[model samples]
Target: MKTGLPFRRPRPLWFVALLTTFVLVLPAPAQTGQLAPGVRGLATRAPKNMKIDGDLAEFKDAFCTPVEYFSFDAKTLRNRAVQFFYLWDDEAFYAGLRTLDEAPANFADDNHLWEGDAVEWYFDTRQDENFRSQAWPTNANPGAVHCYWTGLKGTNIQGRFCLRPGYLNAIPKIMIEVGARRTRRGMEVEFKLPWANFPDFKPKLNEVIALDAELCYSDGGPRIFRTFAYGSPLSVQQPANLGKIQLVEKLAPSLWKACGPVITPVRCDTAWTQNSRPQITGYMAIPPNHAEQIGVIWRNGHVTGDLRSGVPARRRAVAERPGRARHVSFVRHCL
Candidate 1:
């Protein structure tokens, strides 16, 4: 059942560095175009527990918005039948896309994604009141973040978090907590972008920000792109073209039960060898770990060795090292 190492090496360094908690950036107002009446933040009352896995059950209660683009059928081709959902908490904003593709293939390693299929999400954190002043984005509003994730042939998957001036790139600058899972129909993608990642993003009640996204699908060649906004107006280069995201106030925490995976980091020794999968035991309830298993994993693909002994029931292996070890523990349905 396992998908054999989830690709070859660890993601690019730009990505691994973003795994930690984000630091909030200062707020600066930027321009947001006229929001489509339907294109507003879909309220998520409680921070619903979700994983990047291609599971739709978690999204049953979330909002499902339609996409403007789908495929290519020449004269008869209608909407592609793509849906997007939105969620936000104190820390970050979450979005998921359920795309229906008849023939899903062609996933490239680098940003040559246009050659095949890719999903694009553009954000303009500035929301500057004077956004109309600039011809396009400049260093003045550098907090804008453009992100995209890919499931290569439904087997290998990764994300590119662009923080610098560029939007589309062959390689990403940093990585965030992004996940993608392949489904029978096509592929379900999930990603989280923290407010802290933006230099000018400030979280506030009913706070409106610029946001837009789309999905690009291809059978083997050519490209068919879909957008959340009309005419696919939002682009990394044009912040003013992006739609808006209004922060919807949710009920108090007492209203709902806390759901999702509860994760904790544990340390381990480096006795394990490289390429050797560690055995984690002790806890009566074993939670599902991430595919990109932490520790002993590096670009060089080196680890000490296989784990000979299991950690205590509650204690989980966080990471492995040539001479050191650590473990991360999580409980499913913790709510």
Candidate 2:
């Protein structure tokens, strides 16, 4: 039965040397481009001269996380939509809220602001073992902050914040420059939290901090419905349940995972009615040993046709570099 040279002489050898292919799961270093694990958001660097006037002029380009999840208290969730914006500078961190509430009104002050239409922002500044602990950050815990911001009260157009109870009270009242107004679709509010409030935390590239922004709808009473930037079941009780965001120089237009034939810094925005056509921009990384020519097809859900039909699919690429290529221009039509 010795018909084969080595057909049956490999069981032991193969079992002992099964290393033809392998992969190493290594810890990822801080990267500006790649959206890494456990990092749910990005705090992009803002212009030093950004005027926090409740008008999101330059913030149109800022990173926006749609507020979709509703809290357990929401009764009849309709006609309520929101988006949270984040930006940070050396001196202060900025947050913006664009909500679609037809008749926006909040008449609560300071500690009771949560009862009215307002924002409950939870932030954890710790990067150590205590970061994102499930326990409520009481007075003993100085690693996090819970802030409630209200936009309107009576006939005045202003905003204010109530820092976490029994926490940071030793410090002076947080001077948050506020601007709020009612928009056609809903209302917009903007606030600036100076680094002076979080003295231990500094805004630096790749420095991560946990955060969550919740929007409470009052309808002239106790909060009837609410939404959040990133929903955490325990967030109402603890800062440990919030999500994390890394400080970066620029924002990633899309939250693409770390691995892939990557294309990024893509710019396609709605301006939400301000611009009918958005400039589509992207840069695709050229994998090693790939062909010099690459093609990128652009097709929105509204746009029709495909690569086979060759009617609307537009290819966008530019002169190649050592590792990545700059994307030229793409289709101009957008929603």
Candidate 3:
């Protein structure tokens, strides 16, 4: 589903001029709450002058128990760094990200913001073993229902945008905000996600929950971070190899199917008898538009008499129609 309008490339001079004006018009930071005392050392003001090797310390430490720290040092491309922070309250879940860039950043024409520097949040209310399945059970799945916004030079440019939900096989909902200025310190983004959207689970007073967040950038690629409120170790910096995050008290067995949805059962018409040799014959049900193929499975038992018992017959069948069919055998237990 299309969420908003298509991205239009703004003229470079006009884009920069408008962004500068917008930054000047931004309201002063509200005195709602300051950075927690523990993370005061990492708090930094967005750098104004564009210096290549300035103190890259303005990026705040992540508010999420597990968050990624990125360095903005690109030789070929513009050097930029981004930091992600997160916290949860009774009413909503909050995320704050600060980005430092050496050049103006460009957003794509489509809402495909995942192609650029972006932050993604995933919440599993059910806390199922299969995170992807629990978020989206069907084959064509949408990712978690979440919101994303962008901040260019400390100014909020967009708000409460919906993300398209799907995995590798489907189109993902991605939104992009363009015309961010390059400065000594990078851009910063602050976000708030409503708990009403995630009605499946709620947090009690002082209750901590497990959550996962990811950061993607044009320079640094993708990084994943995770947190566990139950005193468990969680890390999201390692995007490709993120360990599983369990939230709920216990996970129930999955009701989803293990194998393919379409199954064709075949019944063999053969009986074992003292004098009659066991023979296999069955009609296979071919799937729509699929070619016919035969497969065979066997069980091993006590071989008191002839070990070569069906060898000759099986060989003869293969020789008669070498290209028509293929047969494979499996032995469960050694006699």
Alpha-carbon local distance difference test for all models: 0.43, 0.55, 0.30
Across residues 1-335, which tens digit of lDDT does each residue of candidate 1 receive?
A: 44433222333223222221111111122122222343334334324565655554555444334442212242222224455666676667777666555565545545455445666666665656743222344443365655555555433555433333353331223335656666655566777666666646677665666666667666645565544432254264465666555555432222111110111111222223335664222111111121122122323334212211111012233332232334434321110
- Candidate 2 structure, TM-score to reference: 0.63
The digit string of per-residue lDDT tens for model 3 on 1-335 reads: 54333222322333222212221222244222222211111111222332212122322222222121111124321232233444344554445544444332325322444444555454433333453342333333222343233432222243323353333322133222222223344554555555555455565432323344555455433222222221122322211122223211111112001101111112222223323332232322111111111112112211111112111111111111212223332221100
TM-scores for the candidates: 0.52, 0.63, 0.36
Candidate 1 yields a Cα-based lDDT of 0.43
User: Candidate 1: which stretches are off by over 4 Å?
Assistant: 1-49, 68-79, 130-136, 153-175, 230-237, 250-335
- Best model per TM-score: 2
Model 2 CA lDDT for position 64? 55
Native-vs-model 2 lDDT?
0.55
| Clash counts for the predictions, in order | 31, 1, 17
Which candidate leads in lDDT? 2
Rank ordering of all candidates by TM-score, starting from the highest: 2, 1, 3
Superposing every Cα of model 3 onto the true structure, what RMSD results?
Answer: 26.3
Candidate 3's C-alpha runs over 4 A off are 1-80, 104-106, 127-135, 138-143, 146-148, 152-156, 165-184, 205-208, 219-335
